[model samples]
Target: MNPATRSAFPGFAWSLSRQKTLAECPRRYAYEYYFSHNGWLADASEETKRIYRLKKLTSLEMFFGSSLHNVIQNAISNYSKSRKIPRPDDLVRLVRSSLNAAYIDSTRHYGLWFDKPSRYTMFRDVYYGDGLPPDKIEEIRSRIGACAESFPKSKTFREISGGRNVRLMELERFRTLPFADVDVVVVMDIVYRDRDTGRWVVADWKTGKESAEDRTQLALYAMYLQKLYDIPSIRDITIRNEYLATGTWREYKLEPIDVDNTLYVLERSVMEMRRYMEDIDGNVPYELEAFPLTEYTRHCERCNFKELCGR
Candidate 1:
C-alpha cells in the first residue's frame, strides 16, 4: 500500500465525532470534549503500534472498496450510454492508485518501518498466519490481479443492478439523533429501484462470516430508510457476505414490517436519550469516572485516558 495524498473526504463535517469518542471511551469524550485535552494515548503503546499497522492495511482495503465503488457507480452512470457498463480497468486503475496512496500514507505515518521486514513479518503473522503456502499465496495474488481483467458485461451488470451501490444521503438528524447516532455511516453497497416492481431494495457486499446479527443490521438500515427518509416503497433489505476465502455469497433479506418494528425500537432509544440530555448541564464536569472497564473493552483498548480511568 502507498500513502494517501490527503485525508479521505476532507472537510466532511461529522456530528458522529462525539458518538465515536463516547463509543471509544466516555472518559476520552469527557476529556476531549470538556477539558480540551488531546493527549489520549500518552504516545503509542504496543497495542497502538499494532493498531496503526492494521490501520495502514485497512487503508489499503478502503482503496479496494473505493475502486469497486467507482467502477460500479460509473457503470450505473453510463447505463444509458453505449448500453454498457464501465470496464473493470477504470475501477482497477482507481484501486491501484488508491492503494499507492495508502502506501504513501503508511510510509509517512510509520516511517521506514513501512518497508521494514519486521513490519511485513508482523502483518503476515497476524493476518495470514500459516494458512497460506507460497503457491497459494501466489494464486491468491493472481486472482486479485485478475480483478482488473474486465468490467462486467451489460447483461451481467443488469443482473447485478438489483444489488449494487446505493447513494447515501447523510442526514443531520441521523447524526445528532438521541438513539440512532450511528457510529459509522455507509449506504448500502447496492440498492436497486426496480421500476417494474415499484420497490426499493438494499444490499451490502460483505467479506466475513454471517450471523443472524448481520441480518438484523441490514434490517436496521431498512428501518432507517423508512423512519428517516419515509421511503415506504422499500420492500426488501439484504445482507450478502461474499467470502473471498471460500468464494461463496451468503445472503439474508428482511421483511418490510420486521424492518418497521426495528425502526420503532430505534425511535424509542432516541427519545429516551433526548429526555436524558434535557436534564443534563452542558457546562458541568464530564463524569467519566462513572464509566468502568467492565462496561466496554474499547475503553481499555483505545482510550488515552485509560491510565486515569484505571487509577
Candidate 2:
C-alpha cells in the first residue's frame, strides 16, 4: 500500500496470540483485528475508537507478566555489564513500584487513557467488571514476590550470569520470521547460549501456572532460534520454561518431529486466518458477519470488550 492507504489499513501479521484469539472467539477477533484498525485516526468512528481503547486493556496477570519481563530484560543488560545479577529484593521492589503505577493508571487516569488509549493503561477488571478483590491482589503480590526471589537464583540464571561464553540473543525483542504466507511476528523473552553446555538456550520466564500452551510457545521460540542463528539441529537447541513463581524450570531438547509439528500447526493457523479475509494478498478482512462469535460466553466474562459486545 502507498502511504495514505497504509495509514488507513493495517497490514496482515500472524502471531500465536492472534491465532489464539481467533480460536477463542471470532467476534472478539473481528473487534481486535478489523474493527480496531486505524482507530487512532481522528476521522475514525467513536465505536472504532472505543474498541481500540478496549484493545489496550491489560489484565492484572498481564501487567504482572509484563513487569516481570521488563525486569528480566533490564537484569540481563545489567548482568552483561556489571557481571552481577540483580538482587531478588531489588526485583521485588521494581515489581511493586510497577504494579503500583499500573494501579494508579487504572484507578486515577481514566480521563487521560480515554483521551489517548494507546498512551495510558486501562485494566480490564476496572473497566468491565468489579475492581480486583483484595485476596486476588494479594495473590498477585505473592506471585510477584516468589518470581522475583526465584529468578536470580535459578540454574539458568547462574549460567547466563556466568561469563564471556554466555551470548544472550534478543532479550524481550520482536524478531520477524517471514513464514510462507504472512510475516510471523514473535517477541521471545530470552534466548541465550548456555555458558556451560555450549548449546543454544531458548528460555521464557513464567509468572503464572504452566499449561500445554507454554510448550507451543517454546516450540515457536525454538523455530525462531533455528532460523535466526542458523541453528543446525532441533536436538541442538535446549528450550527452557522457567516457572519463576514455583522456583522450578523445565528444559526440552526438541526432536525433528517437534519442528515438523510446529510447521504443520503454524501453516494451518495461517490458512484458517486467511479464510476470513476477502482479499488475501491485499490483507482485507471480510465483513464482520463472516466471523461468528464463540459458542462459549465464558471467554467473554473477562474480555475488555464485553461491555461493547453486550454479552
Candidate with maximal lDDT: 2
Per-residue lDDT of model 1, residues 1-311, tens digit only:
12244221112112333445555555555444444321122343454344344333332233354555565555656764445655656655665665455445444435554444234322221232232245643543454445444235222243454354433332332332223443324345554444454445554443224555455556655655555556654454334444332344555556667756765655554343233232232323424454334466744543434444452
Q: In candidate 2, which residue ranges exceed 4 Å CA deviation? A: 1-3, 170-172, 195-197
How well does candidate 2 match the true structure in TM-score terms? Answer: 0.94
Q: Which lDDT value does model 2 have at 27? A: 88
* Model 2 lDDT-worst window of ten: 1-10
Q: What does candidate 2's lDDT look like per residue over 1-311, in tens digits?
A: 34365544478888889999999999899889888987777777898898888899988999889988998889988887888769888998998898898889889999998988887887888876589878889999899889988998887887776554777775448867786766888878777786566688888888899988888889888887888778788787888899999999999989989888988988999899889988888778888788887899899887777877678
TM-score against native, each model: 0.50, 0.94
RMSD of each: 9.5, 1.9
- Local distance difference test, candidate 1: 0.44
